[model samples]
Target: MRTILYLMILGLGMSCSNTSKKNDGIEMDSEIKDTVTTESLSTSRMEADLKKKGYQTFSYKAGDTTYLMQQYYMVFLKSGPERSQDSTEAAELQKQHLAHLTRLYEEGYTSLTGPMGDDGDLRGIVVFNTATQKEADSLANLDPMVKAGRLVVEVHPWWVAKGGKLK
Candidate 1:
């Protein structure tokens, strides 16, 4: 009985910790959004910055997958605390955002898709079967997050390993 009680407490503590971390991101994101009180930056400008950084971008032609050709479609999302704190709404939004991913998975357009939130930013990634970067583009367009401004979409090339590949 004592062991069970201790384990239960541990689980509850872990849950609380996770919730706190998630909320922290939401709060921080809100602060960041407020900081950018100037005219909202344009999407094109964001894309330009990524280009300057030489981020892996979508390319049909095979390059150096090992050297740097590895490609993956990605979207970096900046969200406010208001949206982040509302997990119920967030889940709904996630469903809408992943709709295309769900479809593509069945269609075998790619292997896996997921959204990762960290440091007041959300990053979404989708693995593809081959160099066909179109799959990522098509699905990214479908994500409601991209459509809504909760996230920004940037399609890129990615290399896959056995662990990396979903299937």
Candidate 2:
């Protein structure tokens, strides 16, 4: 049929358009056999790339399907000029706060924690490994800075890849 011939021509044109140039500046043949060869070569190249990045082939089975353990929490602490305590009192509270955070880090309750470089109203962030936002909030509230009303925190539930853990 004429319609079938037209469709075949369109398909051929699309396939020809898909022909790409390789990194070596060579134009590969637009044939099925050439594509199969390229794919096999690509698989080996991919394995080499993964190896270069220190990736290893492995598998594990926990026998548990729960995903709550994978959940993380973040606290965005906003800096404010209005404080219930004086400047000297607030400085003392901040010192105690830093020590408190150090203790939490040693205990593995917090993973990545640090203050922002700028002196903006948005001060710092604390990434917590707790299972729930409530738990993370309770821990954040335990800080002397937050208790003295020098820093306010907005807690948020953070979802990240399980393998993307830094520690």
RMSD of each: 20.6, 15.0
- Score every model by TM-score: 0.41, 0.55
Residue-by-residue lDDT tens digits, candidate 1, 1-167: 99999999999896555432354353234444444432133333533554575534322223212111334444334453344536777788878766766877788666666666555465656665433466556666666766655666566665432223234
Error of 2 at 23 (Å): 20
- Give lDDT: candidate 1, residue 45: 51
Candidate 2 residue-wise lDDT, 119-164, digit = tens: 8888899998775678789999898888777888899877654446
Worst 10 residues of 1 by lDDT: 59-68
The pairs that clash in candidate 1 are 64-69, 70-157, 70-158, 71-157, 71-158, 72-156, 72-157, 72-158
| Candidate 2 TM-score, C-alpha based | 0.55
Estimate candidate 2's alpha-carbon lDDT, on a 0 to 1 scale: 0.73
Clashes of 1: 8
